[model samples]
Target: MNVGFRVHQDVLRPDRALLEGFAGAAVGNLSDAMHGLYTMDSGIRPVVTPAARVTGPAVTVAVSPGDGLMLREAIGLARPGDVLVVNAFGATDRAVLGGTVLLAARDRGVAGLVVDGAVRDLDEIASLSLPVAARAVTPRSGTSTAGWGEVNVPVACGGVVVQPGDVVAADGDGIVVVPADQAAAVLAAHREVEAAKGRPSDLASGGEARRSRADVVFHRTRAAMAERGATVVPAAYHRWPVPPGPTAASRPDRA
Candidate 1:
């Protein structure tokens, strides 16, 4: 019997300038602008203090639900601006990564780590000043079962299928995976969305006004699509309905 272990050494990435464009942009904006084409699920979040954003080409690893072997290998394989994306089946009881691994990744110039499972040593990891996004934290550590996983493979992280070289842009809003081939096109669309709406004065702002605005944007987009015979389903982001009286035609000014 033989185990199938593979690693893709060469993966094409988007231009540096394109990735840099996503530096401070909100992950939600990118997902909304792309019409949720590559949005990751919402459970995963940052554990580090003073949460930082990350944008880089992906170096994907597919491992067992509670294994860290492949992730450790991925750190070595990752490039300076690569985000190590691990598909760990969202297991939370056992931590697949910890402070030591994060420290090594930092030394290797890895941009960030996104784990669908759990991670340990949050305090130490925060001290390293590395951008890390994951589901949970625990004291139980995973076994180093090497030779059982694959690298640079298409892996599902936070419910999104991430392929090697796909651009990953993540922040407190969560992670967004953009196909490597669609990086430029998606970046352009993201720019358009930002330009049309401008950056929110404060992402932390909360009120009925914000909710109403979101609903207005959703309905406006839906109405525009309805005119073209395309029906658009409302996304999860819209927590409220459009206010009375303003239809798509009437809300063209709001976006």
Candidate 2:
């Protein structure tokens, strides 16, 4: 067995309609539906504002630090609306993809690219308008001859274990991964959340309902804290155990 250098040609992707259900869904909502899990770290951000939220099955790629040989291969294998999620060992000093390569992925109908390492060619990338996200940007390029990586395999990108065919969604806010098997349930939960919030048009007139929901959560949290023996006594800062510093009025003016 080649171990780290092998590729698995087949990935179990979610149904097309299931993937389409995630289109235009907010990453925040998806994260919330997952109970605040499956969100990529904040450091991974879109290199450019994507034309829309990129949502599709993940084509996972694992690469040796500072190399992109497998990334290119993944691009070639990707079908339309497949997101290439690259795990580059979080290397930031060398970019694995640049403008030219990103253009190639765009031309190949790749839905988007997310790298845990670095990428360059910001200007050209923006011009191409493909949805690309990475942890950093650098001009230094990596050598492709290292040739140690895998494709269509599970990888850790942005502190999350991304399996091939897991649904990946990214927008300006950030990226979130939905386990392939849980897509339908998460979508149902997301719909429930939206329903509870009422329609976007009703939000302006629903301030009271929003406040009521917040109060319920706040009081529940306070009750839990009380059961945990936590207590708070409101007091002015100057009245605390430590002696208060001189007040502004008591300090001598420089003038």
Q: Pick the candidate with the highest lDDT.
A: 2
Where does model 1 exceed 4 Å of error?
1-4, 200-255
Model 2 residue 82 CA deviation in Å: 0.4
Candidate 1 lDDT over residue span 1-255, tens digit each: 234467776667778887887788788889987898788887898887567888899999888867777778888888898999988888898988888889999999999999989999988997888999889999998866653778887888888899998999988778899888888888889889876675676334678656766887898898988889995466655567767887777786865
* 204: Cα error in model 1, Å: 11
**Model 2, 1-255: lDDT tens per residue?**
898998888789999999889987878788888988999999999877644579999999999888878888888888988999999988999999898889889999998999999999999988887888999999898867467999998899999999999999998889999999999999999888766655445455667876776676689789999999996769655743887888888888832
TM of each candidate vs. truth: 0.76, 0.80
Q: CA lDDT of 207 in candidate 2?
A: 74
RMSD of 2: 5.8
Full-model lDDT for every candidate: 0.84, 0.88
Candidate 2 residues lying further than 4 Å off, grouped into runs, are 199-255
